[model samples]
Each structure stands twice: as structure tokens, then as C-alpha cells.
Target: MVENINIRVANLQENYLIAKHLYLMWQDIGVPDESIQSNWLEITKEYIDNARHKLFYQAFIADISNTIVGSVSCKIFAGLYPNIIKPEYRKQGYIWGVYVEPDYRRQGIAKKLMEEAIAYLKSISCTKVILHASPQGKPLYSHLGFDENNEMGLDLS
Candidate 1:
């Protein structure tokens, strides 16, 4: 078993790997393929690029035993309706895409990543943070002070 883990800002070298892993995980969890292929692709690329260009926002990676096991990304979306978040690193604050390897669940990797994400967001003067959690992630997010939102969405496409 891995003894220790590290969390830090993701670099360009790690972006593709993290994005691919997230794509697979999201697919396995039944994220609609079309959405994953299109929306997520754009969002991931934007986050990766933003992480490279912008210091105010970043994507954090979690590594265990020197292997990247999970990640949490946060960015800003300007001019979106108070609750409408942008997927292209345009949110006014941080929106995370946090995932932990299945085998590593319950080990607190995600939690640590989240804590780091929040700290980073605060450092950049973020007033709020948000994430869309799966059923499995709901408990962890709730434990971290996230609450359910009573919002509705309509696909204009």
C-alpha cells in the first residue's frame, strides 16, 4: 500500500493523463457519452490551459506513491447568471472536478484534495466554490460543507 500522498498544482505534463482518467471514470459512472465527449472535452482543455496561463486559478492533482490518483480543478466564469456555471474555466469562482481512484476510496485523498482546492480558491479571493457530485461523492462533499442546490437546467440544443 502507498504510505503517503502529495497534492499540488497540476502541470502541463499531467493534464492529458488526468483528463483521460477523468473521462474514463465519468463514463464508467454513466455520464452521458455525448456530454462527456463534447462538454467535458472542452471543459478539461480549458482548465488545463487556464492552469498554465492563469495563476489565480488552477487544477490540483493528488498523487499516491508517486502515481497520480485523483484531481480537483477550480476556475472562474464571468458574466454567467448567478448560478449558471461555465465549463470553459469561466466561472467567477472555483468549480472542482474531483475524483479518487476506486481502490483508494475512503482513504481521504479526495478530502485532502478538496481542502487544498478550497485554500487555493480563497487565496485567489474566491467568494464561493462549487462542484457537481455523484452519488458516491455526495457524502464527502456534504462533509466538506457543500449543500444541495435547487436549480433547474434546460438543454437549448
Candidate 2:
């Protein structure tokens, strides 16, 4: 539990920082450098911009005395199937790009960011929040009340 850390919503101009953090997150998850696009930052920024404008996308950052140390992004979940359910019961929020500076790990910054995201989703009447958690993030997310989802994946390579 780190003291004096500030968690706040990210501003529009800070999308690039959020994008960079996402790229770093990929690397941290052992994505080969060659597997990521060279222009990943631009692509991610574009996605964030579009999502922000259209899908209620929001991002949060953790700062320690004015220096950013972590970030998380969330938005309305674009479902894979056709949606017929009412918004009040089936509206889902998605969370992604959760990252923390290596030096700041284990200090509760990530938990704070997650709690903030969950609050935002709840405020919008989201019935559930979803994320594909990396192995490293599973414990923290589990502790935050997230449950195992019904999603399945297959290797297409």
C-alpha cells in the first residue's frame, strides 16, 4: 500500500501516453518485438481516439507527486455476437492496457487504477466489466471481484 499516490482520469491530450503504456504492456507480456507493428503507437492512438469519441472510452493514470507511474483503459465492450439484450441488463464494459512502471509494482497502484475503472463502469450502468487478464494480472483482478468468464480461444497460427 503506497501512500500519497494519486489516481486520476487521463485527459484527451494524454492519449499518446496511454498508447505508449499499452505498447510497453505488450512487451512486458513477452510479445516479441518483431511481432508488434513499428507504428503501434499511432495505431493504438487512433483506436483510443475513436473509442473515446464513440464508445465511452476512458483511461486512468496513477501519479506519484505529479509523475505518472501507471495506466489503465476502459470502454464499452463491443460484443462479438449480435446484441438484443437491453442496455440495463447486458451492457458490458471492457478494460485493457493495464500497465504499471516496473519500479512501482507491488505498491498498490494497479489496484487503485482498477478500482477507479470499475467505478466508472458502474456509474455508466454497465452490468459487468470484462478483461482478458494476463497471467501476471490474474490475481489482482480476481481479488477485485472479477470472475472467470465464458470466453474461449483457439490458436490459429
Name the best candidate (by TM-score).
Answer: 2
TM-score of each: 0.76, 0.98
Task: Please provide, for model 2 over 5-58, each residue's C-alpha lDDT reduced to its tens digit, 9 standing for 90 to 100.
Answer: 999999988998998999999999999999999999889999998899898999
RMSD of candidates 1 onward, in order = 5.1, 0.8
Q: List candidate 2 segments past 4 Å from native.
A: none
Write the residue-wise lDDT of candidate 1 on 18-94 in tens digits: 67767876876787887755666668777667655763657788887688888877765343456554343433465
Q: Report the error of model 1 at residue 5, Å.
A: 1.3
| C-alpha RMSD in Å of predicted model 1 compared with the true structure | 5.1
lDDT for model 2: 0.94
Off by over 4 Å in 1: 1-3, 32-35, 38-43, 50-55, 82-92, 154-157
Model 2's TM-score against the true structure: 0.98
Model 1: pairs clashing at backbone N, Cα or C within 3 Å: 76-90, 76-91, 77-90, 77-91, 77-92
